[model samples]
Target: MSVVILTIKISHFINHVNKMLGKVNEEDLKSVIDNTKRLTGNLARISDNLDEKEIANLIKSAVAKS
Candidate 1:
């Protein structure tokens, strides 16, 4: 019963986000997509340069902050 309620709440939240994004203009949306791609590229480069131990520490730090 609780799991079903949680799923309903999450679905409503996603629907709300979709509605908001639907209102954004085309140029702004394009900029957001470009920035996301750049960030992904940067993450790939950073991971490629880091050792296993360094990557594990970075993950641990991210989890702690969140």
Candidate 2:
């Protein structure tokens, strides 16, 4: 339930951001979506092998880069 709610909230936030940005290039948006999907899938498959600290660091790194 929490995962579903969080996904919905994140989707809404992405939509809001997209609207605010206005006139986004379709190819760039598609590339970002594709990369995000690939990253999430890879993370899900390897999550059991990662510790909480490693996961937190990965999130921090990604956030910093973005």
Please tell me which predicted candidate would have the highest TM-score against the true structure: 1
Task: Work out how many backbone clashes candidate 1 has.
Answer: 0
Superposed by TM-score, candidate 1 places the C-alpha of residue 9 at a distance from the truth, in angstroms, of 0.6
- Give lDDT tens digits, candidate 2, residues 20-43: 668788888889899999999988
Which segments of candidate 1 are over 4 A away from where they belong? 51-66
Clashing pairs in 2: none
Q: After superposition, how far is residue 55 of candidate 1 from its true place, in Å?
A: 8.9
Question: In model 1, which residue pairs have backbone atoms overlapping below 3 Å?
Answer: none
Task: Give lDDT tens digits, candidate 1, residues 1-66.
Answer: 699999999999999999999999989999999988996887688898998889779879977998
